[model samples]
Target chain A: MAVLQILEYPDPILKQLSKEVTNFNSSLETFLKDFIETLNSHKYCVGLAAPQTGNLQRIIGIDISRARKPHLNNGLLILINPKILEVSDFKIVREGCLSIPDFTANVKRAMHIVVAYQNAKGEAKILSTKDFEAHAIQHEIDHLDGVLFLDKISNPASDLFRRVRY
Target chain B: MNESKNYFAVFVLGTDSPGIVADISKALFELGANINDSSHTIIGNQFAMLLLISTEPVYNTETIQNAFQIVTQKRGLTVYTHQLRHEDVYRKSSEPGQLCVIHLYGADKPGIVYQVTSLLAKNSVNITDLSTRRFGSESKPIYIMYLEAEVPNNIDTRKLGSDLNKLALSLNVEIKYELEEVASL
Candidate 1:
């Protein structure tokens, strides 16, 4: 497996809507493997989306197990054509994206979420997640719709902070 | 143009008005000055603005200040401009640390800001953003402070919290603090 390059902001590919992953062939498997490899390359990256790596497909990988609070995660999740069914409990948390390095903004995200999607083998799956995991899933799904956390900021003057360093 | 020699820190303060920002920004824009960084806020009826600006080398601090004389006169604003020193030109990037938010509030009293800030300074905590407000009824005024700071790696957050709690007890105020987690997605 190879680690793919994550496209940064202002890249046209990052702003375009990702198409559905309809093909469940070996090519799809290969892309998912490379996506996981690229995600694991970073020390604390908890999630990644297809558009982030220049693959305009509805796919995402998330593993919040090694995140801040390990006990509150679901180990690893690979979703294809994911759709959020229901969300509850809204809260604001600071979020930074791999595509938009060096900046973080306070974004309001749902604390609990129910999402339905397909697996790599084209099997339907439904998962309910809360807290950080839920936040990560929502963030990744936004990439499918050409949305960035920057667009969700309520107050740019006070909510945006320049990260010290990557 | 030598941008390095033409950097300045500009401060504007006066009664709050609708067109204050537009008027000041228009003046700076017409003078070919680029605002690199700025913070503006309104407290009650007063407005305060702090900006770091850069201009072409030919425009010195006096030239920029004179350019705003008309706006200052018409708007009844107090303006101050100072050429940035070499050390002030570039702010040193912050060290990786535990970022935390501290909230303090209670009955109005003296030495609240002084004591809290002094304790943080002694512990090498860097305050990045701070805002204080006096509210509630005038008969029973309340003081509230919210600040974000970076605690160096060497410091223990538990110990810092305990110390702050003790200080809060002595000052008869309530203090709450939590780590500001920035999720790297």
Candidate 2:
């Protein structure tokens, strides 16, 4: 297994929409191995997407167990063509992308989610998660649509908590 | 040849009007000045603008002020220009620190700003941006303040939180602060 180079911001490839993975073959397995290797190579990185590595495919690798703080998570997951079936609850989380290294923004995301995806063998599967794992999933899925965390930022003080004039 | 002294701080103040920005920018454009940083705001019907601009070394504050004379006279505006020092040309990059935002609101009272800011100063927390607004009826005025500060690595944040909690109790205000954490995805 080899670690692939992660692309940074201003790379036009990151903004392009990723294509869906139709064939789950030997090449898909090889890419998943490198993808997991790349995710593990970075310290404290819990999630990674295909577009981040210049691959325009609907693939994501996540393991919230690697987070510094103890959080409820499934050990390791390789999700292909993941789609959010349901999203519930809301939370404001500050996130920094590996691509956009310089800034972090407060983004509101779902606290719980139900997702449908396919495993490497092309078998259909579904995962329901909440809290940190759910947050990581939403962030990775956004990459499939060429959506960056910067697009969903809310002003820390004034945007969500504006006071009503009496 | 004297490229070292090409920066100037320009300020414009006048009654609010639709074309104030257009006229000011037009004057600067005609003078071939590059606007590096600028902020324009409307405060109680007055238009206030602050700009940091760079131009050819031959142009100075006097020349810039003279260039705005026509616009100033026609628009009933006042313009002030000061040549910036060589050291002030570039802004200092922010130090690596934890980004935190503090929001507080309470019944209008004196010393709220002073008390909060002094505490931050003593702790070496550098404030990046701060805004305060007053609301409510005359008899029961409400004051709200939001400030974004950077906490250096050396500072103990838990202790600071407790200290802020104590201050909140004494001041009878609701103080809430959140340290923004960047989760790598």
Each prediction's whole-model lDDT (CA): 0.88, 0.85
Q: Estimate each model's TM-score.
A: 0.89, 0.78
* Candidate of highest lDDT: 1
Residue-level lDDT of model 2, residues B56-133, one tens digit each, is: 889988999998999999999999999998767654444546667899999989999899999988989988778898
Report per-candidate TM-score of chain A alone: 0.97, 0.92
Q: Chain B TM-score per candidate, please.
A: 0.90, 0.88
In candidate 2, what are the lDDT values of residues A20-132, reduced to their tens digit? 99999999999999999999998778999999999999999999888755789998999999999999999877666788765566788899999999988889999999988
Clashes of 2: 0
- Residues B128-154 of candidate 1 have per-residue lDDT tens digits of 889999999989999999998888878
CA error at residue A132 for candidate 1, angstroms: 1.7
Error of 1 at A103 (Å): 1.4
Task: Please give the lDDT score at residue B79 for candidate 1.
Answer: 93
